[model samples]
Target: MPRHQLRLDASSPTIIVPITARDVTELDQSAAASAAAPAGAAAEWRVDLFTPFTDGGGGDPAQAVAALERLAGLLPNTPILATFRTTAEGGSAEIAADSYAALIDALAASGLAAAVDVEYRHPQADRAIAAAHRHGVPVVASNHDFDATPPTEEIVARLEAMETAGADVAKIAVMPRSAADVVTLLDATERRYRQARIPLITMSMGALGAVTRIGGGAFGSAATFATVGAASAPGQLPADGVRAALDLLHRGR
Candidate 1:
């Protein structure tokens, strides 16, 4: 098994700017924002929500792939995570599982994406992981709870399952109803990170849990998502905002 640690030295507390725009111009803007940010690591092009990939917008699979290729060429060497989150998994679009799997395969084949996000609950999760590994790409096995945060034990179990299923990194995003819920997520993250072999990325959503996005690294979160403009998840600070928060946290500001 390949052991993957958080690339803290490369980009400690990296920022992932969401790209919700459809136009090529907007894509350029998103890429530029990512380039301008202080994040040491690569940026993610959320192709699912971006303009050319969304439903009824002529953002079919071919167009999405073309956009990715274009972005990959433009952002040379800056790792790009290709994510086409499905509606079943808190994403705004609805693409069939088989089609989604094929799209991921295409991205992997192109050698354009450094990483890919695959839902832990997806029926094709294993196949996706295998394909990513075969193509020398890393896989993020992710789970999101938009309604409520699960209990600490359940959270640990879910993360463990992702790890066992062959994910290079396991991510969990939950909607917290209270401050105590944040504690539950933190505790789960810390415990899982210490006990598990794979890297862990966990966060609690909403204003009540906003601090988690800032201080989550201390508890073993490998990465957190931020946006250039619109937040993909609640409580996400903008890319620059996260960078500033991390700087202040590290400096004790």
Candidate 2:
């Protein structure tokens, strides 16, 4: 059978669990465990197989490829996302744009992941996105603002840029210091939901803005990143907690 093509929709929230287990067997078990759980609030439970954002890349490309090959065999039907976030963008690792693009291209061709994430403003985002497209893998054009939320209009423009660059998903993560700032993030996501060309995955990081992580799905965001054992981003709730929250909200509670 052909591989399962990943698709996230606006019907309910797609809760993504970032897998951080260093042990390969542990990672496969996490994926299997989530898949075995009964579906309720979350539209889907997808896996984001990636390193925590602080090391840039602790290992070489060959090691990464080896890991991907393992994941493919372990979770053949599950949707996996391959992401390499840079330290400059609130992640811990950094790689040259050319090499990053090359790595993404290779991963897409490997068929281990259904989608690859590219920092939207990276110098070689276009190259990486194009390469993913050529391999029939979707690209999530992502941007991060760890310090503060940009103006709502500016956020809209950023999403538009991602759409123009051929992203299948336009994602933005921002930090909010106050209730007002979280409101701003939601407003931007709502506006883009109507106008943007593709689905959105936006969130406000940190405790002050944590509500936005769960609430964004109600407003317009299509996906939320949740943690299993470790969190890849701030304000990430555990996957089970996220599903529960989505259930409550979806019921108008």
Candidate 3:
């Protein structure tokens, strides 16, 4: 299948709508919704939430590949970011490091996904990243903190680390306990954005940090995840709403 990966734009971040489903039926519905998203939008298949991969990551590789093929067909025009988020990083699935690396390798080789999300902290993360690149699939090396936001320098270091690890794009999401934490996340984003070679995706999740979803582009984030139906993460405004806000903020640029 021809890949139509969404190109990230720092001055005007692209909107990514996440699709989470537990079964094929729900997958169909969610995919349809994501497919119907406005132009310039992309879809993130939250594979961890899917039933096949929920059983301790013991899901069959062939079945997973087949499902992704079906999903690709459904969203033919939309770029798909295949992600199997692990429980250690605020995800629902729990799989061994080797299995995780193998799964990512398979997805990267399938030619069905425009990109794949690799957990930067996973034990086999380096192996997974190398495999994905070997297959010519761009890797979005990501880290998520659900408890609290790390210091600005720590966040910046993580993003830089992802770049050093050969990721095509670097992403980080953090939970904020106060308004200042949100600033810290964005501050780190800007500091990194000013010097980084690859695109960046950073956001402070939750109600207190919702502004990042709308205005992160100004801080140099390349994309922001939104929602068409069920959100994969917190503080995710609806796709249309986020798009409008982004346009308004970057208008006349």
Please name the candidate that would achieve the greatest lDDT relative to the true structure. Answer: 3
Among the numbered candidates, top TM-score falls to 3
lDDT of 3 by residue, 1-253 (tens): 3276659989879899998988899989998888778678988998888887786547766777788989999988888999999889988877777888888988888988989999998999999999888888999999999999999999999999999998999999999999999999999999999989999999999999999998999999999999999999999999988888888899998
Question: TM-score per candidate, in order?
Answer: 0.90, 0.87, 0.97
Q: Is candidate 2 or candidate 3 better by TM-score?
A: 3
Give a tens-digit lDDT track for model 1, residues 121-162: 998888888887887778888999999999999999999999
Off by over 4 Å in 2: 22-59, 251-253
lDDT at residue 67 of model 3 (Cα atoms): 82
lDDT of 2 at 37: 35
List, residue by residue over 29-86, the lDDT tens digit for candidate 2: 7656656533531212122234522344544566566776776666665677777777
lDDT of each candidate versus the true structure: 0.77, 0.74, 0.90
Indicate the residue-level lDDT of 88 in model 2: 68
**Model 3 clash pairs?**
none
Candidate 2 yields a Cα-based lDDT of 0.74
User: Which scores greater on lDDT, model 1 or model 2?
Assistant: 1
Q: Which regions in candidate 3 have their CA more than 4 angstroms from the true location? A: none
Question: How many clashes in candidate 2?
Answer: 6
